[model samples]
Target chain A: MYDHKTRILYVEDSLADINLFKEFIDDKVELTVVSDGQSAKSYLHRLKQTKSHFPNLIILDINLPEISGFELLNLIKKEQRLKFIPTVMFSSSDNQRDIKDAFSQAANGYVVKPGDLGDYSRAIETFMNYWVYTCKLPQEQ
Target chain B: MLSKVSTFKTVLENLSDGISIIDKEGKHVWINKAMATITGFTKEELLKSSPPHIYWPEEELDTIMKALGETMEGKFRNFELIFVRKSGVRFPVLVNPSPIENDEGEVQYFVATVKDLTEVRRVQHELDDLAYNYRVLHDNTSELICRHELDGRYKSVSPSSIRITGYRPDELIGRDPYEFIKEDHLEQVRQNLHEQALAGNDLIRTQYEAKRKDGTIIWLDTITKTLLDENQKPTELVTISREITELKSLQTKLEENNRELKRSNMELENFAYIASHDLKEPLRTIDNYVQLFEMRYSHVLDDKARQYFEFIKSSAKHSIQLTEDLLNYSRLNSSEFPYKEVDMNEVLENVCSQLQSRIAKSQAKLVYDKNMPSLVGSHILLSRLFINLIANSIKFKSEEKPLIRIAVKETINAWQFSVSDNGVGIPKKSRKEVFEIFRRLRTTDDEKGSGMGLTICKRIVEKHQGEIWIEANEPKGSTFKFTISKHLKESTNV
Candidate 1:
């Protein structure tokens, strides 16, 4: 019944937040979770080396154990094979400085994590509706 | 003829000054009775003594001999000498010697007259001391003392003028005193000096800018008095000037530094607004998650787990409220908001309407004047101030019904406002502490607040260059009084 589900690479440190996102966005998309920027980088590197299919989108958190979301976005944008993939910043920070920095670094989208569970679920559902179903994303080479 | 000579001798003896005659070889040939008293020797002993053996002190012997030689050459000479007496006492003497020449230019007796000068020398020494003191005072004082003619020309300047103006006394002596005055201050100084001269007896003290030799401007404070002549007419102007350039510049620098410090403080307040705003996001997340947990698992969770979840939810909610209030407090200092003309009556009506349910529940009797004037301030901030005060009155009501009275009086350059509430009054000591951020006098569960309302009100009042303070009301309760200026002196822009 889950035929051709959209794939997403979620880079986050908090297990509770990851579990919450998974429960909210359950069967709508196939999710790959990495706790840190380094692991996310290594996972992307393995995908490229194996000539495996790239994820449909990348969701990056700003604060991480190793490399930050900004550095990861820069790395992704620099790679010839990964530059076309859409990257969205997912963070709890709603600071103007953070928002401006995310946009200036070529992040395709930025979303603040909602405080309530219902709102968080609704925000994810809206993001999926627009990015996954309504809009046409570039096909993986 | 013999009696005539005797009468002449008697007349000479009665003279006050000593009188004697010396020969060309410096021998005492004759002397009167006064000479005998002055020399402390008899007239016979003086006549018998020779030049080297006479009463002349050793230091005066050469001067006496020189005068004797000069007199022998037919030239009259006057010399000062110290003479010793037979009793070893010394006195000052002025001696005049002249040659007596006979017929055919042949020199006869060389006659000399000696006068005691002890009293004359004492009077002359006193005059010399006074002149020396005047000279020292003129040259040694740090103040630039100057004597100027009535036409403003410099008659003389003290030695310190060279240190202050970089010009010697001679260089400035004949120049017009106005030449050294800065061009911008020349007219004012001229007018002041002229007025002081006209006033005659009135001394004038004033400050003016002057130019040094290198063309740098300096400020000088001068006290000027007119020097009057014998007829009491103004003759010269005497000015004592002290340099105050350093003090003037220091005052200007202090003002500049104050402005700079105020700007830096504004920037810091803006930073606080940004920081507190950003802090609210995470707090909201934590609060929501805890609420979600409690709502979804209340039936299945154990009593202790439920209590923990409740504590987490409450703490998160408290933090969110605190951060939000902190943002409001800092925003009061933010210059991003513009000040406009706001009517206080309208603002008060709006506040009453917003708190209508609370007022009705608490049975608050709100009173205010219908005719309130318009003031210059932020409309949002002023309305917020009223809302906070009125809401506080309702929240902190005592056993009796709440009565909140808002009044305004027009003061000079400002409108004075007071909001009096008949409520559980703030304690005398905590009246000041209540205005501090996060400081609440009442910590009971019923009186809930983030404790930033009064702080925000105070900041808003201060931003308008006004003051806000609390005082005890009549009979009971607390009254908050503040002022808002009608006129804004500076641009309230970021």
Candidate 2:
């Protein structure tokens, strides 16, 4: 039996947050990290221009330095080629307004960043277990 | 008989009033002794004079001639004139002249009497001066002063009525006072006036809306009183009204500003909640990476290097806790929590079980009321309050085993609860400081706390319209007392 690794594009501003994500998933999945929304948008635009394969999932932070995560989400959803990719809003805010706005914009999921290290690791693990193993996704072109 | 006649003449001479008789041709025919004495002329000097033409002043000569002509026709009774004395001094006098007719009723001589009026004229002048002063004050004042008959008709109104009601004093007089009252306020005004009339001289103050002559409505604060007659019966109503339109509008504006301030404060609190929540993410990330580093490099790292990692991890964790506490505090302003009746016994049981490990380690004994009263509040927040207080008792334990006793009692309007602990009691001086956010009395490393537990408890209690305080427990312990109102109402913005 052969298994393929899942590819995820994680957009976050803080380096420590990026390190935290890398530590949790280890080598189980192929993770690509960008520090801001502008980099993530440019990278996606380059892949589309080159006809490269899209990632299996996109994790976005709501507060970003340039071109907020909301604006980037709208950009991705507006594009027919990239709209099929599942996007999850991973933010520190459990605010009702933020959650409502995310769901109203067709986000697949919203996860609050847990404060405890063990809880944070467990949350990411559960998310990976379901999205990468249990759930089905459209095959990348 | 001769003696009797002499005595009557003496009486006539001694009279204070002067008496005189004038003929039909306006001549002084007969003058008594009193008349000569009053005019500063001798009796012989008055009889020889021509009469009023010589005795009266030139300004009044025409009036005296008119009186003599009327007297000849038997028309004059009593008339007044200004008489000139022998010294040419003028004084006021009352004159009475009547015709003395012959047998065929033809006019003959005229009998006349004169009386001095100096004292009477002096008092009359004083009364006129007082009336003039009163009129000036009444017209110049800003207040609308009015006198109304028992039937509500305006008897008199001051000139200030024009400035207040846009109606001239003459126009308002004799008009019904209720005519100026706004249509909706007519009935209330009538009722108030009627009640005040029956109150018998007691001044009643009230406010109502009235229409000006220009048809603009204004607020009027009026003080009304009833004037009584000699029989103590209500005869008229006197009212002094002042326009209060500006004051009324200002009051409404102040109320609107207060409501606006409260709404903005709530918005600011919501912003604080979101900001603190966002800040926690970075702190958590720092903590997670530090832990990962320690786990991966503990073997190759020196002791000092490992200790540095521990310090970083600890500081990051503490910062995360502070942010979480701030979020919790601000969340109390949210109106999403619905109030319900919570059973205290169940809440206390759950809190103890949650802290079972700590209690087991410290060997603490927990005592509580068998039948705890249920209170109306948010169950989640109430549970959090008890958990913080109970956990605090376990954390701040003494050398002896911790003895925690929870008691509940019924008060006049609320349920009073006391949680007593046989732990190290708080000092009296720092008792109030402990409730402040991030204020810790015990700074030692062993007794570690976020120092936000009591502040959160205070916010929760205040949200429910209750109060919390601390007291010294007997025999070396501390007691935490709090109250919960029995009635459950909607939460207010605090």
lDDT for each of the candidates? Answer: 0.82, 0.82
Q: Highest TM-score: which candidate?
A: 2
Report the TM-score measured on chain A for model 1.
0.92
Q: What is the TM-score of each candidate against the true structure?
A: 0.53, 0.58
User: How far out, in Å, is residue B388 in model 1?
Assistant: 2.0
lDDT of 2 by residue, B1-494 (tens): 57986796677567788877766666677677779867888877777777455677888888887877777767878888888888999989998876778899887888777888877899998998889888887988888899988888889999998889999999999998788888888888777765766667367777889999999988998888888889999888888888899988998899999899988988888788878877877677677777777778889988998888778877887888788888888887776566877888888888888888888888999999879987778877888888888888877777789999999889888888888998889989877877898877674575566798998888888877778998998897789998888877644642
Instruction: Name the runs in model 2 displaced over 4 angstroms.
Output: A38-54, A70-86, A100-108, A136-141, B1-275, B296-313, B336-376, B407-413, B443-446, B486-494
CAPRI level of candidate 2? acceptable
Each model's fraction of native contacts? 0.58, 0.63
List candidate 1 segments past 4 Å from native.
Answer: A1-141, B1-173, B176-217, B221-242, B489-494
lDDT of 1 by residue, B296-349 (tens): 778998889878877777678778878888987876765545787788888888
- Which pairs of residues clash in candidate 1, taking residues 3 or more apart in a chain or in different chains? none
* Distance from true location, Cα of A51 in model 2, Å: 6.6
Clashes of each: 0, 0
- Model 1 in CAPRI terms: which quality? acceptable
